[model samples]
Target: MNPLVEVSHLEKHFEIRSGLWRTVSSHVRAVDDVSFAIAAGETLGLVGESGSGKSTVARLLLRLITATGGSVRLEGREVTTARPAEMKALRRKMGIVFQDPAASMNPRAKIKWSLRRPLVTNGFEHARIDDQILAMLAKVNLGPELLNRYPHQLSGGQQQRISVARALLLRPRLLVLDEPTSALDISVQAQVLNILLDLQEAFGLTYLFISHDLNVVRYVSDRVAIMYLGKLMEIGPVEAVLQAPRHPYTQGLAASSPPMSPHQRGRQRVLLAEQPPSLIDLPTGCRLHPRCPFRQTICEETRPELRELAPGHWAACHLAENLPAPQPRDT
Candidate 1:
């Protein structure tokens, strides 16, 4: 079957100006030639360092911000050139839950008001609105007593559950979860994560789960994609990419993340010599060559296209074949 979502050569560039005239000077390639797909009912975890264009990709996919150039298709319909009415209709098939629960809702509004807005706007039956709200609240494990309270009256966990509940009101097939649990406490985080997993199974929803947390990604994602400096460095099944990352960038990220077990805490890690380069003027050739420990002369002269290193696993690196085997991450 065809994928639920497909992106091709996705690119988003921001123009920067320096002088008083505000003349265009350079472009920051926030997302450059990135491409991936999410199969139906699949969660593709997008992981990267801050400012690596993870959020930018999400915005571009939803057309919350326009793309400089590329194609985004949802269920085979092109999104980039969609008309206003068409885009509005397309949005009904997808929903977004942002990282901060407090910011997602209006402080002045009651929880019921927030939940009812989407249903009312989408022309959901007016009489069934209250019943629908009640049902969705139950799915998120929230009680009706909180519905009359303001957003500030609820706990952080309660607020997030409400946000999730609101997003599902329209019965969307795709949900873009952008660090959905990052702001909650550890205990609350687990609760929210479990709720998301349960909801996905119950709803058969496809997810574009974006987060910096590898452990969370491992737990929720079937496949994971590693991104850096506005490019995809490695992508594959979660185990193949996380446990045995091939690209130096991926290796560096996997190593720096908190170890899974006490015994693995002291294991040696791949360390880069310097930080990432400026996006306005990215380094030539392989973007990662400047800091890659295994970079060779060829790496400095040519950019590596993503190639299959193992079955169903791909990496963009000149030394992927020559690099020493990586230690398996603790299961």
Candidate 2:
């Protein structure tokens, strides 16, 4: 089946200007040659530490920001080159829930107006707007009583639910969930996540779930992509990538995460020897080569493109085939 969303060689570089002239001094490679696809109703988790360009990828997919190069196709429609009208039409099929729900809303606006704004902008009928909003509110487990209150009046969880409702008001096919539960309390997080899952099942929604939290991704994602310095290191089934990580960077991430079980606490952890390279002055060859313990002369001098390593697993590492299996089991 064709992917609901397909991204190909997408690149976004931010130009840095300095001195009086403001001429382009350098470019921060925010996203470089990244590509992935999201199948219908499948949640693809994008995991990485801060500044791995996960959020940037989300914006690029939504056309919230322009990409420097490459293509994005939604339901096989080319998004990068679409005209304003075409792009506007495409916007209805996609919705984004940000990391901070309160900040995404207008603080002065009442919840009703905030919820109604999208439908109104999209030309939703005035008479039916209230009914639609109420229905959506019910779906997110929110009630109509809070509609009259301002954003400041709602709890973090409520605010987020409202955000979800607003995003789904248009009945978008794809939902970009950018750390939807990170800000709430652990209990609230669980509640919000359960609601999201319920809603996804109810709506048959396809998700691009982005978060730095490994545990959250593990819980919510069907397939997981591990990114480093604007590049994908490994991508595969959640268990394949997380439990038996192929790439060194992915191994480090899996090892560093809080162990899933008490028995697994004795497993040896993988750690990178150095820090991530600066994005503006990214090293040639492999971006993670500086910190990679298995780096050889070839690794330092040449970059490795993603290659199939297992039935459904892919990794961008030269040594992936030769590396011993990761310790999800006692060695």
Candidate 3:
């Protein structure tokens, strides 16, 4: 099966201005030289800390924010440079579930109106949209009564379900889920996840699941990508990368997970101190080397390329030699 979504050498930057006259200017490297792909019906989890540029990648892929560089392709169709007219044709197969349901929804619009917005935008007729809306609502386990209520009247999970329903109104092949469950309670989150799984099984949808929570990623993702600063440090099957992470950052993330039993506790979690460097004046070479406990002289002068450390596994680190070689993950 071919990839449903592909991004290559992607970059996005923000120009900063400071001082009394705002004369001091610099560029913040939000996303830098990133690349990845998602095969049809597969969920690729993008995991990273708050400032690791995960959100930037999401916006760029959706074309909500223009890309400073690189390209994005959907089912081999180029979307990077698509004009307004061209984007309309491509967006029918793509949609995004934002992190915050409230921010994405119109305050004045009823649930039905909100749900039908995307479908109408995609050029569906009123009659066709009504049928699709009701069917989509049912698919998310929502009731017909919800269509008449405002967003405030609905529970958090309900609102999110409506968001999901709206996204699926067009039967998009790919959905960019940006921390879809972050704002909901655990019970609600579980319900949402179950709905997502059921929907995927039913629709055979491809997902780009972005989140900072490794635990959630473990459950929802088929594979995971570890990111730091503005680049991918490691990526592979969720089990392979999470159980035994090859990169120091990824290992740190795994170690951070509490052991279920006292007997299972021994690995030293990488303790990172001090805040990340300012993107406007990023450090030379590897940005992670500054906080990496195993940093060596070479780490400060030469940036390591993302290399295939194992079959379907990739990582970037100069001290990779000091760590154990990539061994096939035992499951």
Steric clash count of candidate 2? 0
- Encode model 2's per-residue lDDT on 142-230: one tens digit a residue: 88999999999999999999999999999999999999988899899999989999999999999999877678888899999988999
Clashing pairs in 1: none
Worst 10 residues of 2 by lDDT: 260-269
Q: For residue 10, what is the lDDT in candidate 3?
A: 94
Shift in Å, residue 282, candidate 1: 0.4
lDDT of 1 at 274: 64
lDDT of every model, 2 decimals? 0.88, 0.88, 0.83
Query: Model 2 Cα displacement at 98 (Å)?
Result: 0.6
Residue 194 of candidate 3: its Cα lDDT? 90
Query: In candidate 1, which residue ranges exceed 4 Å CA deviation?
Result: 259-270
Which lDDT tens digits does candidate 1 get at residues 2-50?
5999999999999998899999999999999998999999999999877
Give the lDDT of residue 244 in candidate 3.
Answer: 69
**TM-score of model 2 (CA atoms):** 0.95
